[model samples]
Target: MADDKETAEALIADFQKSIKDAFAVFDHESNNTVDVREIGTIIRSLGCCPSEGELQEMLAEVEEEEPTGYIQLDKFLPMMTRVLLERKYRPQPEDVILRAFEVLDQTKKGYLTQEELTKYLTEEGEPFTQEEMEEMLSAAVDPEKNVILYKDFVTLMTVEDT
Candidate 1:
């Protein structure tokens, strides 16, 4: 599995150029520093999907050392690199996510209803806590249809290998 994926250095190297470019945009004074508050915006610009708590954690890391509410390009790069390297932060393959849903669908429906998902996620192995269920449903479920909408979700969760 490791052999099939890009090396850590390679992944960081590929990500750095764009990260640098985006950082530059936020560094208004051209002083290699950007407002710490804007870090989340910069991160999201790169298609990074960090939750609010995660963003706060990342922000804390960048701000703790400086304590000036600003982060240098040098400082920001390493943190963003780690985010890119974290497996949980990376998007899964569309087919893989779709297949996982398919396995649970049981009735051959492409989507799972809220109750069906509530049962699976809450009652199954390593059950999700109520908070987790709410977070997932907010993202993946369709309120009108009361279904998981995995097909549309696959688009949001997967990145094409280029």
Candidate 2:
């Protein structure tokens, strides 16, 4: 619908701004360019997980012939925005998500109470904010037993590629 298109456009604009800001950090010379070698690191730093081959292909798409060791902002923006909007980096695999939850489960109980998930999420690496925790819990938790329904939760975490 029109709303979906508008939302997607807004998302791309947001990604472009964020990509530009991240790209600027590596620009160093204010040249509006980044070294081809550091492209992977830059993309990962922005939280995407493009494979080496994908990155190479993207670079190839952006530059016609032999690359000049640097990728311009205009080239970087569209590619990064596309990948981000496509969620190419996130939506962690179900097995991976299960493994992470298993680690938190600790007792091998195959589940976690709201408290257990709360403690780990708010105290662990790059801890989620209160708002983030609430959002995740609202989606992933089973209120009756107060345990996390991680299997069901996987659906919430993944986006089926359209």
- Candidate closest to the true structure, highest TM-score: 2
List where candidate 1 sits over 4 angstroms from the true fold.
1-8, 91-162
lDDT of each: 0.80, 0.80
**Ten consecutive residues with minimal summed lDDT in candidate 2?**
153-162
Rate residue 13 of model 2 by lDDT.
83
Candidate 1 pairs with clashing backbones? none
Give the Å shift of residue 128 in candidate 2: 29
Query: Compared to the true structure, candidate 2 yields what TM-score?
Result: 0.54
RMSD of each: 6.9, 10.2
Model 1 vs. true fold: TM:
0.52
Q: What's the TM-score of each model vs. the native?
A: 0.52, 0.54
Task: Tell me which residue pairs clash in candidate 2.
Answer: none
Candidate 2 achieves a global lDDT of 0.80
Going through the candidates in order, what is the number of backbone clashes in each? 0, 0
lDDT of 2 at 99: 86
How well is each residue in 81-148 modelled by candidate 1, as lDDT tens digits? 77766633444568888888899889887898889889998898767789879988899887788778
